[model samples]
Target: MLRRRLGVARTLKDFQGQIYGLNNLGTLLLQTGNNQAAAQSLVEALEIARSVNNEEAEGLTLSNLGLVEFARGNYFDAIKQYKAAIVLRRRFRDPLGEANTRNNLGDAYLAANLPEDAAIAYGLALQLARTTSDTPNQFRAFRGLFNSYTEAGNYPPAFRALNQHIALAKEEKDLFQELIWLRLSAQLYTITGDLANARSFYEQAIALARVLEDTGEEALLQNDLAQILYQ
Candidate 1:
């Protein structure tokens, strides 16, 4: 049915409608694990976008192609596509697009085992997200930074990025998520030899666990907190 509509749009030479349909169908195909079909649709969309000189549409199609390549484990290909999209996004003055593409580029860099590059990309994404007041993307950028730093064995920076994520997440007031982040914060602090901070986080998690009536988690946190205090 969707393809039929796309066919109609194509036959009518409805450039805008056709491109939108193709991009949407491509995304749906990717979600369903039909990478080949997704790529085909996206390729057609890219051709149409380029032919029509629609940089924004071209950038979007390129970004979708990046995801297809990433899913296929072609990190370099994904990076190429995302970089292309970023250039177009920047040229078009699309902060949101640039932020998203930069984040995707970070993921590609990370997948390519280039944590430093990933960190750089994620840092840029974070700044862009912050500038645009895009809270969700800011959270995503911070999460990516945390992972990138962790992968690079840079514990302090990783902890800082993760701490920012926790701060932002606290606004959501998801108790279970809070408990999890507190536990992770404690672990990261322990790794960094920040015993006092570790103890504080562990204590926080323990109290939350008690509130949630999670006796097992409470016991674990208490034991960990005790060990930290003994230090």
Candidate 2:
């Protein structure tokens, strides 16, 4: 309806509007696990954003690029894109955008085996979330921090961050958030040689993932569980 009402002529003239459509399309494909299509659409969005010198749009497109890289397990490339997105978002004074990109940057760094760098990014993301009063991002940042610290071998900070994330997820009544946090906490515990706690959280995560019908999350947790069992 919006596109029809706007008309092709007017929409084409509005670069932002055109990019918006591309952005939505790309995001939809990304959600459906179509990395190639998502990357194509995201690149188109990036071109439009660059043409208009729209900082916000550029940041969004870069973030989307990071997602594509992550899907392909190109963690270093993902980190670069996410960092670029964060810089653009910060320059635009878009706290929410900065927070999101920071979270993605942290994830990319962690995937690249740079946990200390990931912790720094997650810390910045947490600060941005607090500044913006974005509860969801705050929760996400906490979880990111937890994982980063755990991977960095900073057990105390990791435990603290995990507890904070779990508390926030409970307050938000976000079962999915809780489930992910549980899985992460479980892995941390397993790494620290706390098998009993690891098993407990793994069971909780598996149960919640099953209920949500999230095959991706289920598979990830299964792999983690298998590793824990192996040890």
lDDT winner among the candidates?
A: 1
- Local distance difference test, each candidate: 0.89, 0.86
Regions of model 1 farther than 4 Å from truth: 172-180, 183-231
lDDT (tens digit, per residue) of candidate 1 on 101-219: 99999999999999999999999999998898887778778878877887888988887887788887788776876787788788778877889889889989988998999999999
User: What TM-score number comes out for model 1?
Assistant: 0.80
Name the candidate that leads on TM-score: 1
TM-score of each: 0.80, 0.78
lDDT of 1 at 125: 93
Question: Model 2: per-residue lDDT, tens digit, 1-231?
Answer: 534533562556878887777777778788899999989988988997898889899998999899999989999999889988978988889998889889889888889999999889889989989887899789878888887887777899999998888888898899888887888888788888999999889988999999999989999898888887887
lDDT of 1 at 78: 98
